[model samples]
Target: EPEVTQTPSHQVTQMGQEVILRCVPISNHLYFYWYRQILGQKVEFLVSFYNNEISEKSEIFDDQFSVERPDGSNFTLKIRSTKLEDSAMYFCASSEALETQYFGPGTRLLVL
Candidate 1:
């Protein structure tokens, strides 16, 4: 079955650098999203993208974060400033429809 995939299962970064986490969503899906879960905390929605622009976003998706579909098969999330609080498992998800989303295993980001 086709599934969303993320690279660099775990990343250890310094407290003030840029990082780009990559993902390849399901080929046929129309909607894609980014969600993150701080270890032991609730999963929080970051942003949703469709038709090449942001469809929706939460407060957590501040100026530090950006998402893009750089090609037909890949999507990416770039963080401009890494903060200690930015440590979390970032999940990439895709859905044919809007409500139900299938998530990738997740890219664990740790800012030290």
Candidate 2:
């Protein structure tokens, strides 16, 4: 069975610092996405990447954020500058199609 994996399960950084979170999805999957949940808040979509290009992005994915697929197996999310409000649990997900998405455990980010 294939599953998504994330690194640095928890991170703490000062405001204004840059952060890069890493994820590796199931090998045969075609679609990738990033989502975030602010503690008690609901999950919100950040961006979706497919075929080496961004297929869709939300307003939350502003200039401050970026996504990349460094190699055939790894995907990354970079936050150029972190803000206190950016503290949240970030999730990486993948799916063969838009109907079902398999999510990673998540990386908890805390900005102080």
Candidate 3:
């Protein structure tokens, strides 16, 4: 079965450093998105990318964050400066339509 894969399943960084998490969604899925879950908090939407541009973004996606599909297969999310509050599970997802999304296992990011 086709599925999303994320590299560096776990990441740890010092506060103020930068971090980049990668994902490879099912090849044929057309839409990509990034979402985050702080330890005890609800899942939050960060950004959505399509056609090589941002289609939508949430308030959480501030200047410190960015997303890209540097190649045809890999998608990435970069945090220019990590903060302790940024520690969370970051999930990448893809969907053929706007209604349903298939999510990656997620990369666990820990900031100190």
Stretches of model 2 off by over 4 angstroms after superposition: none
Q: Rank the candidates by lDDT, best first.
A: 2, 3, 1
TM-scores for candidates 1 onward, in order: 0.98, 0.98, 0.98
What do the candidate models score in CA lDDT, each in turn? 0.95, 0.97, 0.96
Q: Write the per-residue lDDT of candidate 3 for residues 1-112, one digit (tens) a residue.
A: 9999997799999999999999998999989999999998899999999899999999999999999899999999999999999999999999988879999999999999
Model 1 residue 30 lDDT?
Answer: 93
Scored by lDDT, model 1 comes in at 0.95
Residue 95, candidate 3: C-alpha displacement in angstroms: 0.3
RMSD of 2: 0.6
lDDT of 1 by residue, 1-112 (tens): 8889999899999999999999999999999999999999999999999999999999989999999999999999999999999999999999999778999999999999
Off by over 4 Å in 1: none
Per-residue error at 40 for model 2, in Å?
A: 0.9
lDDT tens digits by residue: candidate 2, 1-112: 7899998899999999999999999899999999999999999999999999999999999999999999999999999999999999999999998779999999999999
RMSD (Cα, Å) for all candidates, in order, is 0.6, 0.6, 0.6
Candidate 3 segments whose C-alpha is farther than 4 A from its true place: none
